[model samples]
Target: MKKIFISILILLSLAIASIVPFFKSVVIEDGKTGKSLAFFDAKQGSEFSIEYIHSIHKTPVREIYQVHNEEILQTEMRFQEFGVGMPSGADEGEVFAQKGENYILSNMKRTFPSLDIRIGQIIANHTLLLKGHEYPFSGLSEKGSWVSIKVDNLNIWQRLIGGKKLG
Candidate 1:
C-alpha cells in the first residue's frame, strides 16, 4: 500500500508539472519601439494599468483604471461621431493631437510642444476598453502601431490542480 501511494503521488506531480505552463501568463515586448504584449488571467473587479513610453525622450507614462465588466475604456475615442461641430465627421487623430496640445497648455502651463501629449495620443489609439473575461487587448501608438494582449482561461486540468497564478 505504501509503494502504491508513492507511485500515485509521483504520477500526480508529473501531471501537474505538465499542465502548469498552460495556466501561466505570456508577455511579449518590443525592444526597439518600447511596445509590449501581456496575457494573464484577471479576476472580476480587479484593476490594472497600461504603461506607454515616449519614443523620443524615453519617458514613462502610466494610465490607471479599473477593469469594469472585463473592459478597459480607451482614453480617447478612435473615430469622430457625427454631432455638433463635426457634421462631416473629423479624424480623431488630428482632433486628439490638438486637444493634447491644448490640455498641456492649460494644465501644465507649458508653451512649447511636449511629447507627453503625443504619449496620450498613443495611449488613446492603442489602449482599448477590454471586454470579456478571456479576451485579448491590443494597444496601439499614435502612428497606429500596436501590441497584443491575450488572457488565457484555465483548462480542466489546471482547474483540477487548483490552477497557477498568472504573471
Candidate 2:
C-alpha cells in the first residue's frame, strides 16, 4: 500500500507541474500589428486573457477598447509615451492605465523618430481595473514596450524603424 501511494503521489505531482505553465502562457495572434491580440492555449475556465502588441514610430493613434461578450468594455484612448493620452469617443469611464496612475511613463517620440518593438509578456495582477473597478487586465509593460510619433508628417527614424500599423 505504501509503495502504491508513493507512486500515485509522484504521478499527481508531475501532472500538476506540467499543467500550470500552460495556463500562464499568454499568446497574441496577429501579433505583428494591434489587430487581434489574444491569449493562446488558454484554459477553458480562465477568467481573463492577456494581450501584448508592440508597434513603434508613427503608429496611428486610434481608439483602444476591449471586446467582451459582444459588447465594448471601455472607451478608446491614445497611447503615447508609455501612458494614456487624450481619449477618443464618448466617456466610458477609467481604464487600467488611468487607474494605475503611478506607472513610470515615457515617450519614444521626443528624441528618436521611432521606437523598437520587442517581445511582449503578460501576467495576472489584481491592481488592473476596467472602469475604476478591479478586474482582469492585459497590462502593457513600460520597459519592454515602445512607441513613436510623427514629426512634420515624416518619421525621424524612417530608415531605422518603419511606420507603425494599426488595426
Candidate 3:
C-alpha cells in the first residue's frame, strides 16, 4: 500500500508539472459559439491582422490588411484543425467560409484600392492540417468569397506549438 501510494503521488506531480506551462498561454473564450480560444498567430508579414482559436482540431487563421501602402495585393484566410485528419467527408470543410464571413468584418476594404481573395486551401504545415484546398491568387480586385479551412491531422502537435515553420 505504501509503495502504491507513493507511485501515484509521483505520477500526479508529473502530470501537473507538464500541464502548468501549457495553461500559461493566453486563452480567449468566444462566448458566442461556446468555443474556447487558445493559441494564435498572424501571418509573418502583414499589418492590421489577427487570428485566434477557431476550433478544437484546427488553428485559427487571420489575414492582415495592408491598406496604408495602397498596393494591389491578395489576402487569404487560412484555417486548420488539429487532432483530426484531413477533411474526408464530402461536406466536412464547407461551412467555415460562411462562418468567416459571419464573424470576420473589418473596414479593411474601404481603405485598400484592390483586394483579390482566393479563399479555400488545405495547406499542411508542420503544425496545421489544412482542409478545403483552393488555388493561389495573384493581382488585386474587389472580389471576395467564403472558404472553409479545417484540420488535416492532430498527430502533429509539436509542429503547431510555435506555429508551423517551413524547412
Task: Pick the TM-score winner.
Answer: 1
Residue-level lDDT tens digits of model 3 in 24-70? 12122222342322222223222333333434455655543432332
Q: Which stretches of candidate 2 lie over 4 Å from their true place?
A: 20-25, 30-59, 62-76, 79-167
Best by lDDT: 1
Model 2 TM-score relative to the real fold: 0.24
Give the alpha carbon lDDT tens digit for every residue of 34-120 in model 1.
343334455544444444443444443333333233243223222222223222422433222234312111111111111122324
Q: Candidate 3 overall Cα lDDT vs. reference?
A: 0.32
Give the TM-score (vs. native) of candidate 3: 0.22
In model 1, which runs have C-alpha deviations exceeding 4 angstroms?
17-41, 51-146, 154-167
The predictions' CA RMSDs to the true structure, in order, are: 13.0, 16.9, 17.7
Better of 1 and 2 by lDDT: 1
Q: Looking at candidate 1, what is the lDDT of residue 62?
A: 38
Cα lDDT for residue 110, candidate 1: 16
Candidate 2 weakest lDDT stretch, 10 residues: 147-156
Q: Candidate 1 — worst ten consecutive residues by lDDT sum? A: 105-114
* Candidate 2 local lDDT, 50-137, one digit each (tens): 1232243322232323333222232333433352343332323333343343222122111222123343333213122223333222
CA-lDDT, candidates in order: 0.36, 0.30, 0.32
